[model samples]
Target chain A: MSINKIQEITSKNNARLTWEGCSILLDINDGERMVFERLTAGATLKVGNKKCSLQPLINCPFGSLFQVENGTDGPFLSRIFSTSEGSNDLQEEKESPTVYGSKDNRELMDNNTAQSLTGEDIDELRRKGASGVEIIEALITNSATFEKKTSFSQEKYRLKKQKKYSPRVLLRRPTARSICEAYFKKRPEQIGFLRMDALALLLSMASVTSHSDVLVVDMVGGLLTGAVAERLGGNGYVCNTYRGITPYPIDIVRMFNFGTEICERIVNSSLTELCATSNVTSVSSSQLEEACGTRSQSNEEGPSSSVPSLDMGEIMISSEDGDTDISPASLAVKPCKATKVGQKAPLDAIKSWRENGFSSLIIAAPQIDAWSMVKELLPLLSFSAPFAVYHQYQQPLALCMHNLQVGKMAIGLQISEPWLREYQVLPSRTHPHMQMSTSGGYILSGTRIFGSK
Target chain B: MLSMELENKVSFKRCIREGDLVIVYERHDNMKAVKVCENGVLQNRFGVFKHSDWIGKPFGSKVFSNKGGFIYLLAPTAELWTLVLSHRTQILYVADISFVIMYLEIIPGCLVLESGTGSGSLTTSLARAVAPTGHVYTFDFHDQRASSAREDFEKTGLSSLVTVGVRDIQGEGFPDEFIGQADSVFLDLPQPWLAIPSAGKMLKEDGVLCSFSPCIEQVQRSCETLKSCFTDIRTFEILLRSYEVRGERLESWENHAGGSLGSRKRRQRSTDGSNGVEASVSATIVARPSSEGRGHTGYLTFARLRCVI
Candidate 1:
């Protein structure tokens, strides 16, 4: 975890240090597909013959294309641009024939043996200060098949060559969406299958303002937790609860590198702790009064503590010790050598939780039944507080919607998935991208309300 | 009304204070922003509400009027403000506002320039996004609209972070001082192409720009202008559909307690894809999509300003 923190320090929105260990989105096959790749110095980072590395960077290497440091002798290095907009539009580069036809033009095609440039020859060309465009130009000039191709085919051929020859890597800044995208691409299982689009919908439906006090149970580790915390702008608490001996997924949380205050907003409690302490809805008014009575007494004894809510720091620590993954450095647990903190933490959490009831409940628990999970949390929110639940399949979310209807617990329950389509709008060829991923999980949204309470 | 941020922070000052922007919630759909004053009185359908009575009450507290009617005085956030603010022109809703804020990457400490701050709905979100640090310079061609938006900003306590300017951005352009200074720019005018070059000039290298237009032709023309100075240009439309969900008493409903005609109509409505789970139990769930919903707002065309290498 500490090693990851150091990596994060060097890898943050920093444009100057996009060297080894930098995360990037590799545009492969002329932007047909995107592969999320992390850069490693002196290592072969190939996106179709475009090998890259970090070596002897005396100057900033942004706004430049990738190339070999010493051609065949050494590693890759980014060279300065000869001119701004180094690779001009392919169409304007050279005047070509008419557009390509659907069928292969066998009659017009020329069959001939061309001068084939070997690997060493290409390396020598690169070593002799030949640009990617110049090398492609030389190859096209020496090709016997170049004359028979149509204009459209020529553009396609040039783009293909550019992808293979052009050594360019985009150093993208890490945003919440980008990190989420990388997670979806690389480590999707850790995120409860909640895609970025569905998560977007859930956040909006929950009305997650910066001022909101949110109760979150992120089965997807801290992906949802981090997102909600970021949205809150460190203004409110993200009271996080998980079942069993679940370890907080700090790896994903470290990507954002939020400070101690933001991390402090993320208070944790086990289900054993929560279910044992309080179920305010099931309790009668007299019991509520008794609980309030004790809460006042506790507040008097622990001034500035607000009863158990503000006193569970010790409880959360011992409860977290069940997992070996908890970093000792991150948790400064005051040497309280007792396991009794778990029981008090939840009581304190609920006591503090009911004080300024949560404005929203955001859940991404595909592992649990959505209705049961939502039903248990609904009573904790203020009347008319909104909630959005995420499920990979619609069945569970739909069940929760039904339960909301039966109990009259919420209104305006909507289930939706954002329909996103990427379009390629070139001057000549304009249409939607050929390949697209449709499902971004399912989101069920509603507002909590009471009837004559 | 007090800003949600302020209300969330200053717990000691809980009551409705003078000059506070308060969201007076009369119903789910009917809500309005009322400026709280020491002795001001507001006459509504419920009764004449005295600001004096509401002065010492906490936010989210219910207060009574002279006629024994009551209303909720809640803190105002962008979402609530958007719903309650009077519309001078076609305004973006919460869905599109959230999408733009996220996609444009409007973090705190970023400089954003927007054109024709119509109704200031999106502008408010942008201000909130870049709050306590970043500043938003908004330009509107219409003088009255610009002044009105400026007044609204002042009333909402966002004047410090937002500066409203009266300028024809499409015809003239954004002020010269902001050229190459803004981190991102937004266009909500009819002919955004006329302003794209100016928007490009206002943006820093690799900065993002978004143009909201209802028609596809506008998006096409704006894309043409955007191509010269932009990369990765894309368009999107965001829609939010809400459902009304409620629990039903299965046994009580089956007994025809509401009479034949009413129950029959309810059953007809329920059978129309309401209850997917067919279970003979004590209670069942029912959800119907809201009949009143926004259909189409505008297409948000976002593009990144190409590096000026």
Candidate 2:
């Protein structure tokens, strides 16, 4: 209803206007266009021929309210300070007699004399210890009066104490951190080993997630994968892979037994592969050792390591070329009963870390096919162990071994998304290998490269 | 001082002293007396309490009057001043001000450019938001209005944030240095379409721009200029409705009646009941009735400069 009244007033004339709680009634010529706008609260209204403006001692809406007034005094202009009729009446009743008839009325009128004051006038008044009310009164008194009924109309009402308004800083609700914490609490068991990139993705998802739904992340960045594993309750596995030949197999066996059960199994298998591949003219044990040293050094200094770690078991696995005569099955050295070795392997080790009553599968692989094989073997070995996959150069992918289906779903969804199109390192000249179809599965048409360059 | 209980059922805690007068609460139904002893008592039906009671209380506190009515004792915050100040025109609301602040990135040490100081609501907000630093230069063609705005600034202790001038922004652009020095520019006058070129001259390379208009046609024209002058131009409206949040019954009166209905048929019946119409009537009428039903205040268009080049 107030909005309608405001609209009516604004539309009637092109005068700029404002509204407080009440409508301002301004005396303007009919159909005359005047600009209306807001001043700071407690702003005075300049009226008539006076140099000073009339300061309404009440809060009014910001905008101009217009109306036509006819008088012998050349159509004098007056703006309504407020329009709350009841309050106006009450104020009028209290101040009318005193303002009009009191001996101090002369001083009030003197104060009300409309005069134009510059910034210096205002400063001088302040220097003289004048209050805002006093300064406003002085300005009003000094200003011109274009209307003949100024005395009666102005004297008819008393100036009510103006209520002061100020700006406010709105308090915003808590951010995504609280919500993410709540989500993690609601399903503690669903969380697995998280990597840095995975954690970042989770944070992003938390930013947009509603109260419903569990978060699933498919980690595809190496050390970043380890970082995430640490943040999500550290109850998963770390998987690593190595490749080489001969005495390198011996070093791989030493590294496999160096950790837990899963770690030992992984190291033993890699050593066997190295031994079998040592006979190959193209590879040597010394080269294998050099590759291992290089991978370790790279992991220590990179953005890939920024992932928060989740406390979990680790299964270190490595592979290497073995002597051509050594059967791949013999190359499978299960360091413990908990470790599982597959048949079609050049040579690999499977070590399981089953301490603290939680099994974690850490798989380090040089090839996508090897990683896939480890993933397939995950459910059979330990359904609850969280699995971490580490790959150099390529995006490391991992899933909670216990929640195999969810892990698969997360990978499927990510592969279908267009996030890869924005990758900076990808050669732009070549057409993208993955395309998002209308139905949402990625239409893959190019050769799939796995493992580090 | 009479010992009589006031007819409005307001009880006096003490007598008024010299230079002190009792003030009644507007919404209180009962009469109560407050002692004006240099420290006056704000009395009503709620309870008789000393002004000292609210001295340290934060703004937005609900103090009880002598007659048991609740009186919201708002602190002398900038927003409260805007709520109570006299305006010669329509004023900007907190919703609009919030967006303007965010879009403009209004902060200390920035020069703000505004046109047509109407009620000075935005001006007050800008003043306070950028206070202790920053400056606001507002222009209006009417000398009387500008003077009035100047008075308001004096009262709110925010005259420093603003510089009121009597000039038409459309006639001549702000001075060269003033133009390029401004961090943000807000246009709240009619024919804001005419002020865009001035905005271009005045705004910095990545300065923010905003235009508040009451109609879509005005918005369309403003947008055209904004597209050429700035980049990342976006327009949005903010609607704020306060809800009575008391315990589990947090609800808004506007949405209470028809908000929970899940079925289309039931919703139709409810709508029909309110409008006295049959279900067979067009759904368009039920969904959106007429212009009268719309909250036709104005449209706000915002833009940001990507590069001067």
Candidate 3:
């Protein structure tokens, strides 16, 4: 907004302001030290072929723009004011304005007057020490004014109008608070009161406090069962079985490959159970297979699949193996997959759960068959504590009743103590597969492997 | 409806009406007890006295609890509202607020405009920063949300610094007068690009602007609009993970072993294992009690205003 400097005001009343092809007429008393103030409003005035508006005419002892227009015979002065309004006004008046010549002088200057200067011409004058008002007068006097064109055109005016409300800053990413709030509002009852563990885990993930590495483990029911325990220990770890589907570590790597099928697969599988349930009918086996295949491919090809794997047999082996110093290479193994109904997949799922660092599990299925299957798989995995299970159907479901470390724990079945009542073996009609023992614990009726026997 | 000067005092009174759920620290018996009522006496095993005696007194003044105990009635600050507000959702924390304010380079006496007034936590901070001469106009599409935010603002006495309105910024552009009048604009809503054109219409030339998004895809969309409307667009993520500092066992736990802090420790250990060694040496086993750590939140993006032409 600061234009070029005014060299000198030779005569106050008849001073000629010149720069580039523009000039201004300052009508002031000769020999009088006059303070020319910058025009705040209505500074754009026309006197003849030449037009002028207020400019921040620097180096003139004061910051003022005296608009002057050139006529056929002489220079004509426009609206004038004394300086002293404020520095901010001098800044505001810099906005581009239209300059016109007075109507009376229009016909007389048709042959003598010069064409009015454009904004570009004024900019050049401004760069060359001519004040905005001075530049306007110079352009008018030098060029013939057959109908001087104003500095402001309809297009320029429209552009200025369009530019009024542009934001200075654009928020590039959504805040964690905003996303969490949206999620919570939509599914409050389902999520319940966010447990301190969950809040702490979220806070850690939010990275609001300090920096630390986190190892999240996924369990059976997709619940973050160990998040609280991990949070309580002041270690950063979150356990949610649901996160296993779209491995966060993998997602972090391929985040930039846009339009690729990998990205599409990630987006399609990003939702939680609600989305899963809604789209369940639409999900074909081929899609599920493809998802599983992609996970396998990533595990084989990506560097992030270094997460440890747990084996059931290694856990059930004698105490000697527990004491043995296992090498890191011996411990490494392929990631586990869910067992198909008929296929005899390795009992590695439970092993993987243990290796991943989860101490508990929650089961949502109501079938006793599933519970038996889980019981059959536990001994095959290496874990210190009895994996806790919560039955979703029961009001205030029983959790963490058995003390596996202290008692005669069953490896496979061994008709050992059953934690839940009404326990029965699946594919059986003859007798209760499980019966109550005199000590309040129930015993299994079927034969199962006993790792410790 | 009160002016900003009077709003703070009234907000304190409203906090009292709201059960003074936010605790004020007062010393009594070398311990602190909550001041429950403005008029009723605070009685404890130590002594009892009325809170009205401290009404006109300046904040941070000492008052007597009924139990003959002395308590400090520290005035409620913005931090208190952040902790005590009945959050219908996760509220923006101090960390994000600090970063957003600093990165945006918000100045005093500048007009700031924001949309999607979520919980008003950030709004309160913005209002406080640009007080006296500055103004903040916040918009939210949901009436209920706006009302809740208004209540909080009124209680906090920051309502005067801000103007709260319930309207969809995407559907209706900013008012004509406000166009090119704002010094800055912040969009915290989903699909913020929908309002970019509107933002362009309201900001002064070369003003500052910023946005908050969670996913990279969202960032990509926002960046496209930002590059078109403004210059100097940039994006980044802030990660905060805490360490466990307890007595001589000052070390981070192994649970948070995947973050930047973990890498730093690993680098240190690789250089000097003797310095890193402590109680346990098992490679995979977490040797020490892991200190709690913070992890992922979201991404942040920033941009600066430029001449459209």
Listed models, DockQ each: 0.21, 0.01, 0.02
Q: Scored by Cα lDDT, where does model 3 land?
A: 0.37
Poorest 10 consecutive residues of model 2 chain A by lDDT?
A: A443-452
Report the candidate with higher lDDT, 2 versus 3: 3
- The predicted structure with the larger DockQ, 1 or 3, is 1
Write one digit per residue (lDDT tens) for candidate 1, span A1-453.
Answer: 122232233212323334555444433222223333334444344433344554433233332333433345433555533323323344232232323435665534443355366668888888786767788888788777676677544555555465456644443444566556655654466677676666765666676655566777777755777677666655556666655454233334434434454555655554443443344456455654554454334333321221211111211222121212111111010111111111112344455455545667888876889977887777666654668888877667766776565454655456765555545444554445555556677788766653312
lDDT of 2 by residue, A1-453 (tens): 122232232211111122232222221121011112122334333222222222331332222232112223322223432233333223223322333344343433332334365659866765565644565566456556413324433433222212100001110111121112212222222222222122333222111111101111122222222222222211122233233321111111111111132222221223232233322335554665554454445433322223222221212221221211111110111121221211111112221111011122333233344335444433322111123333331222211211222223111111111111110011111111122111111110000011101
Q: Give one digit per residue, the lDDT tens place, for model 3 in B35-125.
A: 4456566655556657666555433344566555755443343433454566655567544564565454343345778988878877876
Best-fitting candidate, scored by DockQ? 1
Stretch of 10 with least lDDT, candidate 1 chain A: A330-339
* Chain A superposition TM-score per model: 0.65, 0.19, 0.21
Instruction: Give the per-prediction TM-score of chain B.
Output: 0.88, 0.65, 0.68
Candidate 3, residues A30-61, lDDT tens digits: the string is 10111112233333322223334333331221
Candidate 1 lDDT over residue span B136-224, tens digit each: 88999889999899888887778877888899999999988787677789999999999999999987666789999998788878877
- Over 4 Å off in model 2, which ranges? A1-453, B1-70, B245-294
**Cα DockQ of the candidate 1 complex:** 0.21
Clash count list over all predictions: 13, 166, 77
